[model samples]
Target chain A: MALDFTIIGYIAGTLTTFASLPQLIKSLKTKDMKGISPYFVMSFTTGLFLWLIYGLFRNDYPIIIFNIISLMFWIPLLYLSLMDNLKNKIKINIK
Target chain B: MALDFTIIGYIAGTLTTFASLPQLIKSLKTKDMKGISPYFVMSFTTGLFLWLIYGLFRNDYPIIIFNIISLMFWIPLLYLSLMDNLKNKIKINIK
Candidate 1:
């Protein structure tokens, strides 16, 4: 049987992109972003944004779709990370 | 000046793929995968494999390179999860 490679791309794209969700959920559940490194997230988000731009340039539907979904997940996590940092800063200032 | 989109792809690929390093290191340092979901890893691994296959079929070097690196981190993490589960099983059997 001939392999439909595009289907594989779709499945792979969805899995890798969505994998971040569990970590985001964990951070929310525990209200702890202690384990996640900001360096990784900042670099990862920048990379994803570039990928999204690339997708648009190529007009690749799957790339565009998946990259957008990834940004949706990552941006909020970044925001949470920022919020966490802000909280630390405020505590330090008060003390 | 015209933009070199390929460089953008490289940055994005490396960022997204290597983002797992911090998580992997955390697991190793703390010896805890309690926060990591096996379902996510399984699905993510499947996705990365397909992406690697797609890269090979398309002769896309960045895709191939990044996906392979991602698997490097993920496969070991998967093994750790399996080992953790096995240890849990042994504990139950002993009781």
Candidate 2:
């Protein structure tokens, strides 16, 4: 039963962690942050961070592993968002 | 103990379900699907669909509720992606 639980959790984590790839690719290819909300990413990342801490405290490797991967996925998005802001700033300044 | 588990699950679900808001807003505002990867959303939605099923089998209301809300979040994304495709098709057809 415990093994079943672990298997379930593992499968769930794997699929979700992998799911971020499409968005990551999209962001990378277009380099356009206009349609992606910074706030959503911000809140989601914050939520994931807390979940990571929870998983750590519980010694839940699956949760930790998944969130870590998610972190990798989100960090670039936030960075891209920042870059977009910078570009906009430059554009406005030029104007 | 069950109460505690329920509380934990609810908190987790609430935060996650709510996290989709920013992305929805961003998508609505920019109407630009270029930066968002359709494949990622597709896979993620598929994963969520399975999770919802699992939750249903387990009678896990939290999971069911969260995924249903997530469905709400993702459906729009998929729709937006389709619209973007349609627009592109029109553009190509015009050319």
TM-score of each: 0.79, 0.81
Question: Which candidate number maximizes TM-score?
Answer: 2
In model 1, which regions exceed 4 Å deviation? Answer: A1-3, A85-95, B1-3, B81-95
The DockQ values of the predictions, listed in order, are 0.52, 0.48
Put down candidate 1 lDDT per residue, A1-95, tens digits, no spaces. 12676677777788888887876777677767655566666777887888898778777888888999989988988888778878888999999
Among incorrect, acceptable, medium and high, the docking class of model 1 is: medium
lDDT of candidate 2 over B1-95, digit per residue (tens):
44654455456556666888878877888787877777777777777777786777677787788888999998898899878978998999999
Cα-based RMSD of candidate 2 = 3.3
Which candidate leads the pack in lDDT?
1
Candidate 2 residues lying further than 4 Å off, grouped into runs, are: A1-9, A93-95, B1-12
